[model samples]
Target: MYVAVKGGERAIENAHDWLAEERRGPADIPELSVDQIKSQMTLAVNRVMAEGSLYDPDLAALAIKQARGDLIEAIFLIRAYRTTLPRIGHSRPVETDKMACDRRISATFKDAPGGQVLGPTFDYTHRLLDFKLAADGEVPEAATAAPLQGDMPRITEFLNRDGLIQTETPSDEPPRDMTRQPMEYPAGRPLRLQALTRGDEGFVLGMAYSTQRGYGRNHPFVGELRIGKVSVEMDIPELGFAVEIGEITLTECETVNQFHGSKTQPPQFTRGYGLVFGQTERKAISMALVDRALRWEELGEDNLGAPAQDEEFVLSHADNIQATGFLEHIKLPHYVDFQSELELVRKIRSEAQANTLKEAAE
Candidate 1:
């Protein structure tokens, strides 16, 4: 019989000490600063902020350092730290139309209002590695262009004006906060989008890919994708007006999906929306796709039994923290369960042999 071993506190301590050393690497090498990670590894910090559901770059950088550059682990650290902070007040919803955009593009239209500002993207860059970066670790200054002034109109708005897209009626009902409240099945669009914004990037990407491969084909076109800094506002009860809290970089994606009209409705384009912290276009686009897929019921489309269409499946498995906990738990001791299974297998084999022998003798 296998018995559980205890008294490994000292061993665990030593193992953690060794792990710290390993994370630091050679003693001769200079330690990496949190600022360095924050500024240089901007994308990583962005991902941590997006997944962790916190926008503090400094804290995200520190979490990245503490997590030994493990993005998921850093996200976990940020989430844990966030839970400890007191909630003073809730911020009024941000207005993306007022965003100071750094990058904006639309695939649905050839000539958008902003004229497809590429801005700081790797889309046109060659995949070839530059050895100069490894030796010098210095980036050359990019050529500057005159910044686009004034608010750029949304591509969806154009469609809406023509009545070519389904009219989205604003609801006065307050959105359910997924963080505070337990998730319920048949979730509303707002709650589903919230889950996707904080969902595991890879998982969401895969689900989105599945949709593209005809799992739940909803002929999606990137209506518009904008990356920018938007002012966050808070409605102060005493002040009688919303005040600007702070600015946060966000990536917003609007996917225009095909929607043949239902019995009562006219044929018009339906939309899927995604908004996440920082410049993560891939995640934003994937989120939009998944969001549209989850809207099957609302759009009156036939549920083709796709994974992305299944609300319970996507929402339940979207969080990396919960998925990691359950997945990594397999490493823990399961000796008793294994032993019971082993004994049962042995007994079954023995019985089978005796029956085979009896049949041969007969």
Candidate 2:
């Protein structure tokens, strides 16, 4: 009486229809416009952009609305859309010094040349939920003013001035692209940053938290954290000049760590760096901490066998898309594998019982 399932095509079609209906929602209620999502649910859009490795906040917002407010699903949509985008060209390395910064802060120093500009932050806000937002209450707009103009020198630059921190030689070498290439063991900084930029916020936070709790502990100070847009340019050989391709919002973090200099050199501090796609301060900061922890050996510090110290472990598990895909895939049919396992366990138990019976009879 057993028959193979034959409704897969119909089931799939029906599922797709249901999903489309759900995304649109009740006919009476006004559909959420992309602009509303972009302006109202900005953080979700930011996260999608951050993880999707796409800089278009509007596109991310649209993706969020299209995906029915599922952030991970929105990221997947943006990534899928991005994958088809042809690589027009590469850009000149953006000089952070030239960045028109919206928000910048340094933890190592109390005051720098630019002073601490607390531009557009929710750091001190109470966690209480606002009921007025449900009714869409109007709020007064703050008076506009130009951003703080003075240059805030990097905190690490101060250490570098005194030869107290590791000196980083700026390289003209082209970094490897993670999306275009498979990740190899013992990843370089460029590759690590690529993965961290797209990494799950919660996962990176946990790894960073572990480090703070004395797991592969390194005394780290937020050497610098900057959020701004960087212009991307590519040189056209025919034109014989670099041309602007696009601009992207980025959050960059650099941390200074204590390192006991080895036989090769004098004792000095080192740097751990993090760079991400958008205004993801938490992720960028966590990434910086984890980055430093991974450099224990390079800095002549004892490994202490910390989880954060394991680069392979941290990089391999930080991505939400990868994690969710692998985890949820277990729900797919695996009857054949389950049957094999069932047979093997039964055989083992039967053998053990038989052996026990023989011993008892003897």
Give candidates' CA RMSD values in order. 1.9, 2.6
TM-score, structure 1 vs. true: 0.94
42-122: candidate 1 lDDT, tens digit per residue: 999999999999999999999999899999999999999999999999998888887888888998998897688888889
Work out how many backbone clashes candidate 1 has: 0
- Model 2, position 213, has a per-residue lDDT of 89
Best by lDDT: 1
Stretch of 10 with least lDDT, candidate 1: 144-153
Clash counts for all predictions: 0, 1
Q: Top TM-score: which candidate number?
A: 1
TM-score of each: 0.94, 0.90
Score candidate 1 by lDDT. Answer: 0.90
lDDT scores for all predictions?
A: 0.90, 0.82
Between which residue pairs do clashes occur in model 1?
A: none
Model 2: ten consecutive residues of lowest lDDT? 1-10
